[model samples]
Target: MQRLTVFLCCIWIGSLMYGEMVAFWRPYWKCSWPPLQQNLTEVPHSHEGFKVAVITDPQLTDYTSHGLTPGSFAVKAIQFFTDIYMRRSFRTSLLSFEPDEIIFLGDLFDGGPYLSDKEWKESAERFEHVFDQTQRGSKSRLTGIPVHYLSGNHDIGYAGFHSHKREVIERFEKVYGETNYRMKIGSVEFVIVNAQTLDGSMNENSTSSSWNFIQNISADANPLPRILLTHIPLYRPNDTPCGAYRSSPIINQRISNGRSGIQGIMYQNYLSEDTSARLLDLIKPILVLSGHDHDQCTVSHPTPNGPVIEHTVGTFSWQQGNLYPSFMLLSVSALSSSTTSNPEGIVSTNLCFLPMQTHIYLWYASLFIITVFLLLSWPTSGVDLSYCFRKLTELAATAIRTTSKGGVKVKDEDANYEYDMVWDAEGVMHLIRKGYSKLSNANHGEVRSSARGTVVARPAAKKQTTPESDSSCVQIESETNLEQIPKGPRMTKGKMSYIVQRLFRTLHNIAVLAAVNLPLYMMLLIKDWT
Candidate 1:
């Protein structure tokens, strides 16, 4: 018993020491191992080359940004959301240091449709509120330097839906330029292209090389660095029978509504569309900036012809629990500064991991439970070996007798716990784990797509549950009835309370003994060594 107690104490102490380390422990995980990228890159238009910040798909729908209903809040699945905020913060901070131009990649609004008209108005109002805040003032990255923006698939009504798509565009154009235009910071030229047209993608022989329209500007310096701004990037090679260009969005819900018989088709516009690759091959300019994927990544490629570097800035807010926020801050040197101090250096990227508030709470709770467990194993110096043995044996016997009859029966109050359905984002149903003891054991279908599209061949979708529908019927269970209890060493609040109280008492007794016997413990150590 003494040896066992000593072993357990040693283990508990080790755990206690590492508790803080584990609490803040961030695992070393990089996105996309060996990121599929090309090496041999170059710095384009070094003289007037400036760092431009890009952020896309803020997706501030009623549900996402300002919670759909009053007092409504959405929690995320994991830690990535912090990355989203931190990435933006980093970019902003860098802008403070490097003083670069900035741009929003687009999709500023999410969920253009609200079932209730009130909800729709409220959603639009909230968007204007926050976006105004984001776009206002000279202290922010948007205002301090030159901040430009473009439109995203989500921002423009997700395809021909009646909403504030045009209004939103107008608001943006009023602050920035008219969605599509050009500007020259110095030797490097910037062309803001609104690639938000729906028919640009699906319709065959659409005479829109919308990207090509920007290149024809008379003010554009040929063979000088030209940076292109776009929302969706096209890098994947086109495989359609028509042999179109390609760079596929991982999962694309159609930008328009003439759906094929599927959820949504994954597609790339053009391998070398008006993007950095094509711009590099054509204008032979330097860099390009884009947003939409909301993941921090930089790809520098050396084509057989020339080299190009492109960076994708992440989103600024948490969405669907994936925190991806990043920015590009550049120090634009005059053509004279090319020969001065180091031209390009990465100011801090402030890629903060998601905030650990929730995880920390659970961690501390588990540690408290474990500490109580350890203290119960402590030895009592006052009792003789035989006396201690007798006391433990008696307690053990009493526990056995109590447990044999019936152990830990759950109460009726627990079985009657209820959960309330709140807002209607696409995926809040899966996040019910936040409310403890409210989970139903229902087997849902294997499908993950929340949308059903035409032309895109996907499995049949499960219908959305209405207020009148019995969603509870879809829950899985081992037994047929709702109130059926499983046969086991059942858990009970009363039993847990009793166990916890006992552990607490044990901890108090151990602490008292340790304090009182400090001198004796030291003397014993000396004597034993001697």
Candidate 2:
């Protein structure tokens, strides 16, 4: 029991150290910047493309989920821990890659749309805390990099649904700037669209504004290659694959009829096919980046210009369904001259994964269970538990003797009576027999007789029970039993059985540990490879 306790303490300490100091930062160390066509080192500083960190679907926790109730300790604890996990990942990524800009692909909060004004403000504060740049020191990498935000269905409800109130949209815009806008960072132009409004099922005014924004951007005859950033992904067939890095193999698209379907206000998998086509046609962007499905997906949409690639980035928070949270790094550079062969300079992307938080917790849990099982089932040879108990009783009698000397009376007869009562109540003799039977064969049946004799002899002490007297009696009885016990063949067989049991136990424990942890390791390795 003592060994098991120490083992558990060591495991607990190791888990805490790894989770806090090592796990969150290890992935970033393993990941490198996505390579460009022309080596970045060879290019001039002005022409070297900028790196953008694309984070999506963080979906910060709120009272609506995780069985969290308002004003409760559990809710506060969960929120704090979750926010810290996200903050650590973000900070580590910034420090590792030092991206020139950052983009949040939305679903910033799980209950953003439905939260009350006070609740909404609190959630927004948590969002700021998770992505805060001001707190980081001047020496920090990516110290003043700009971060852009997009509106998600969770942030502002799906357009045309009853949940899509004008006030909700206004609240989001008030805090996060305009939902539909365009900006140029480095040499590439990025068009940020509120794809939720493109559904056109409701909120006519907002939907109209979104369309106008798209039309205005499309009308501009800019020479720079355009990249579209939106919260919802462009529509694709239900059978579309989300690539090897996606947690789920298939992307299921579910569309609902206006106000008549079982799907609630929150059920949107992708943009409507018509809206997708309209955005593709008007924007005519060279690339599209979106984040609503909370997983990595890459698909190509055909256009007259060429095939436009759309990459849906995965979530950034571990609280979401994804076990391995990740973000994308996009390297974009502008070309010096426009040509028929290649008008754009270069754009390359790579998905960098975060630690598997769920798997780490599983490791801790599995370790505890394995430790407990081994401790309870471990083989012990010739170590008598009853003898330990007898020693404890003798110690108690010695303490009582000292107390009696100091003018406190503890009767010898009473002590003996109490000891016999505890021994019978706990069935110590029965326990000894059961323990010995595990290691002793039929030839070692005499061990059980010796254990029974020890118990019977204890009850015979009716006159006076003292530590010295009990110790002398037990020592003489033990010696006699040792002399009478046969030691040649029977003892040799018991020793061999004990050795075999220990070997089998060790092998079984190894197999169990491998079964529990091998798949997790394989998954991390495979994801790293892809």
Candidate 3:
């Protein structure tokens, strides 16, 4: 048991040290591992160097207050906590990357269809607080950073339907301004396309306008390296044989209607393959950034002009469908100041997956329980109780001894009483024998001193000495010392308590290791140690 305890102790201590080391390198852990590094040699741009923080499908929502039914508060509380964590993590990642600007590629709110005018304003306020740095009284972690917003099907209904009403669109415009806008950073031009409207879901006229806008940008007289920013990725050739790009959102009972049943066959989240191919041909964009599917993917579709690359980033929020949280950082550098005519520049994109340490929660909970158990498991001393029991037994034996002298005795029917008394009496006798040995040694020493020149008979000296009286006196003295023997037992009890405390501490450490999955980290530490 002792050896096993010591070994577990070492593991526990090592686990703590390992935890501290990881915490110290937390920033690196948050950004670097599981990173996708790609140099977009196809992208044409020019700059000293600029970084764009690309995050998609934030889908931020306060689901806690949504559908307020019985026992919904717990779900709401959890959602609230998750929202806070995700927002903070997103902000931290952006700051870590030090992006010049940020692009939120849609579904900034989960219930865009259901949001009232007031709710829309509130959601917009939260968006500004989390993502926009210029807003006053904002909790924006990044200052002086500009953010571009894109509209997803969740924000407004699909192109071919009125499921998302015009009033909802009006509310959205009040907060985020126009859905489709353009911006130029460095030598590159970014054209934001409203995919929801581009699909002709609201009206044919809106679709025609979006198409015309794309055409105008594609036919720019002095076109720079143009990039398309939208919420849905263009369909790949293999997405489906018949023409739809991918599966649609699950139609649950709450949102299902007369027109919703067969909608899965016509995916609302993805653009048509034909439209995608046409857009690629027209713009001849080097890179396309999009997000609607929570999965991260990069697909290259061959166009008549060239191959257009679409990089879809994963969701940064916590949800049932979100497998892992991720974002992309696009870096652009200018070839030269005079490269406005020749806007081909170096572009590198790194897709970063945030570390998801879900096991740490379990580890913390386990440590707390173990600590509480150890505190309650403190060793207790039963000295007073044992001493009282011993005194009672001694008294009973003394009564029997005194009565035996009179040839009379009380009936002692307790079977174990006699056995216990016998053991106690034997212990007293052993002490008496020890006292006698000590007295004998003292007498022998005195005889040796008195008879240094002559041989002295130790037996004669023993006989001359009245050892009966001496024995009686020594026995009384021994009894007095025995009366104080409880102190020795008390010291022994303290030693036992100390041992128990050490054992509990060791157990606590082991519990922590088990909580944190010690074996995995132990291997990591060993590898690093070597």
* TM-score to native of every candidate shown: 0.45, 0.67, 0.57
Structure candidate 3, residue pairs in collision: 45-345, 46-334, 47-333, 47-334, 64-76, 159-200, 159-201, 160-201
**Candidates 1 and 2: which is better by lDDT?**
2
lDDT of 2 by residue, 204-306 (tens): 7887788888878778775566788989899898888777887866677886555645223346788878888888888878889999887788998888888
Residue clash pairs of candidate 2: 160-202
* Candidate 1: tens digits of C-alpha lDDT, residues 67-127: 4444343323222233323332333233334336656777665644332445545544644
- lDDT string, candidate 3, 1-530, tens digits: 33443454565555455442443234445553222122345334332367787888867665423555523676556555455445545554456555788888988887676667666677666665555343223445557777778887677655444333556666666777777778887556788987876555323555667788888877777676778888987765444222122223322112122255422212355677677877887777778888887767677778776676677787876552654567787766534324333223435566776534344445656755655554445334313657889999999998889878884644433311100011122233211211232223233221211111322222222212212322321211213446656687789999999878767665665575465656665565443322
Which candidate has the top score in TM-score? 2
**Poorly placed runs, candidate 2 (over 4 Å):** 1-12, 39-47, 135-138, 162-164, 201-203, 257-266, 334-344, 377-530
Which ten contiguous residues of candidate 3 have the minimum total lDDT? Answer: 415-424
Candidate models: Cα lDDT each: 0.44, 0.72, 0.58
Query: Positional deviation of 214 in candidate 3, in angstroms?
Result: 1.3
The lDDT leader among the candidates is 2
| Per-residue error (Å), model 1, residue 422 | 76
Model 2 global lDDT (CA atoms, 0 to 1): 0.72
lDDT of prediction 3: 0.58
